[model samples]
Target: MSSRVQVVEQPGLAPAGLDPDAAYAALAARDRRFDGRIWFGVTSTGVYCRPVCPAQTPKAQNVRFFAAPAAAVSAGFRACRRCRPDSAPGSRHWDHRGDLVGRALRLIADGAIDDGGVAGLARTLHVSERHLHRSLVAEVGAGPLQLAVSRRAQTAKLLVEQTDLSLAEIAFASGFSSVRQFNDVMRREFGIAPSGLRRTPSERIPSADPALVLRLRLRPPYDADALGAFLAARTVAGLEEHVPGRRWTHRRVVPLPTRAAVTEVTVHGDHVVVRSGADVRDTAALVRRVRRWLDLDADPATVDAALGLDPALAPLVGAHPGLRVPTTVDPWETVVRAVVGQQVSVAAAGTLLARLVAAHGTEVAGESGLRAFPRPAAIAALDPAAITGMPGSRARTLVALAAAVADGSVALGSPDLDEVEAALLAIPGAGPWTTGYVRLRALADPDAFPASDLGLRHAAGALGLPEAARALGAHVSAWSPWRSYAAQHLWTSLAPAPVKEPS
Candidate 1:
């Protein structure tokens, strides 16, 4: 069953790096490996589909390839009903690419377009609107607005299928300007009204609770237990908690743009269930944050393949196949954590952060027994002497860093990694390890490696690699572009092996 299609030069039709021949091959074979990597639109049906679409493959002449779903939509193709490409795991390409288009897409997914229009997004990226548009169109085959529209439609569709929220609430929550616009966009994108996408009662996953529960899809081989343990060890008392139960469940107060919500996340085999009490309008943003925090969009196979090449990392990769570098839901909170974590144990840092949260964190409106992490302004306004646990110099550094973020001198949301790194390094007491750790988790830099980290150095020494920071840094260069995952593997290796009971 060698399904093949003739790939012609469709100049300006496909994204820059996508090979039409390879894309068509994947599509024809219904390859699951290419699920999020590529999409195709059929001229006859005027519909786009995921690579793993179960439908019959179309003719070569009528097929067109796109790197992103937004590109297909922008080219006047509706989503395929059968495959539901909108719910596919996000492309791993975005994880490593720090290019202008990549950065723009990251911000767009985070609701930057909904919060601020195209012009504002461009300004944040330090680019002119025209330049930004041209670059995205050239590389991604769609401009910012089309991408945003596609995102909204996907969010709306997810809400329609999963939740019992009203159409009006879904519209507002998905960032549509009005209910009519939501209906119009939904119909235009999916060739169906919003209500038409809903699942029957029998098809819905059952939940006994009243909370808004949503299933987030992810690539497989996820080491949920390992990731949970990492978060559990560093859990701040009032802000986040990990329950001891049959399933690994973590509850945390997520501060969304519109409001703060308490999210209860339970990790399953292939996906994680998110239960939240936030307003419907914040669902889309909350989903994005949860995905990012859990590092769910990662293609573990790809990362494993790359890092597994090294002799030292091969055993690690074999031992823990899908370990993830746990990221932050809030960039500011991560920055605070990174600064406080410098030269201190993880437990000590968590204890100090809990105290800080108790002193300055704002209470959630409806949720009792939880508080959001203190905002930068609150920390920045503090007197240096007020921070009780840490050294006075470190206290000054935290306040300085907080003030820098509070006043917009440091843009955590910026896509430009170099600029962000420079700003962080400029803050007094923020060293390579602090900035690198922030880049690793908060900013989601895949290549971010804090070579000077004590844990990393110690792990490298134990692995028979170079023990010194400089030597270890040089040795780990072979694991470039996925050093973050490599770091996770190394850190996990440091944990004590579980004791066997007379097996």
Candidate 2:
């Protein structure tokens, strides 16, 4: 289905448009459905708030609805104090679309612009800087620089409220060039000095252990129990622990001035609380990457609407309303896992991966037993014969993949999905299933489906759908852009017993 709202290039209004009367109605109702996707700037108070803000609603004439927070900010409205609009979950609008704008937004959230600058971002997207800037400004209400600043402001706000770190530390940690720049942006964005936004001492993060506790927001109807079960089944020994109805802990190694941390994630109502040993400097990146790994930003309503149309998927969709395609925090690690998992059960793959980690992965500090997955460089340095418990052919394939990644031949972080797939396919013994799994988990591609997998084939057979991989692919075309979610539902339905309900 197409989007209902259209974009109009009007001055002093958002670039994206909806009927003003309807937007005001949604606000009056305090509609949580539109909370993240829409913001209303109150002319009377000169503040912008989410549609679901609890403060008294302003008169319709005094309100202007924006498709994004940036549009309201660009129009000269500061974030509302009561609502804290920046804390809302990210717009599912970006997650459901696969356009240039959507891809750019995802990359920005991942700190691509912070690491590469606008010029580097454009180069990675295979577009000229002029074209990229113009396109962004026309589609959204801001240019690349403004969007990046807005992102940094959000990060800074979270740090100020949650941590006891000095303003100077928070400044550079949030990617500001200097304390002066940070101070200026804070005033402009929040209309307060950084110190004024500090949390109460009782709420402050513990100073002794020095960890950052932050919330990862998401749309409602999240199936936490299901997600926990999936991760628990695939947990690699010494690298991760998943306790049902409790918490999941995993070690992460972040790129760009490389750092390591162990993250503990627990799902609260409509949000996930994350406790990480990553320094305040790395917390913003860690949170963003973990959100991507869990696929938290996905819009369940949009996905369900699309996939529920199919007779085969309709029941499963209804049963599992918020099923997510589990992804990896590390792209290279996911690729290696996919290769090791080929032609094996989930338990067998976990054992092999645990052995690989014991042999080559670095031991990292954490409350839980934590070990960083072997980096491409470390894996490449190893002798193929040393990677035991796999066929010699598979061992050679793993060695070849590691060397390619280490030497920059098979780039996992490429912006171009086609190029990444092509590079993966070019390597010997990296088959279609392995490549598709990597794309689905590592790249966070929502449309990727490993149609050749035995589980999927069996599921299709039981459902009386096309059983062959090629035929199944053709039949599943209607689930475009959400096939990965559909596959998860199919896999869940294949279990002999009914799947447990969320706690």
The residue-level lDDT of candidate 2 at 89 comes to 71
The TM-score of predicted model 1 comes to: 0.93
| lDDT, residue 413, model 2 | 74
Candidate 2 RMSD to the real structure: 4.6
lDDT against true structure, model 1? 0.85
Question: lDDT tens string, model 2, 1-503?
Answer: 11122333334534235577777888999876676777888777778898778999889877877766776677677888887898777754665455677767767777788889999888878889898888777667667777888889989988888877788999999999999999988887777788889999788545466667887788778877678777877888877776654444433444324567777788777888777777777766777777887778777876888898998789888887888888878899899988998898889999999998887888776555568888898988878888889998898899999999999999887766667889999999998998988888888888888899889988888888999999998888889878889888888886644345434
User: Which residue pairs of candidate 1 clash?
Assistant: 173-281
TM-score of 2: 0.89
Model 1 over residues 347-425: C-alpha lDDT tens digits?
A: 9999999999888998986645889999999999999998999999999999999999999999998888888999999
In order, candidate lDDTs are 0.85, 0.79
Separately for all candidates shown, the number of backbone clashes (residues 3 or more apart, or on different chains) is: 1, 0
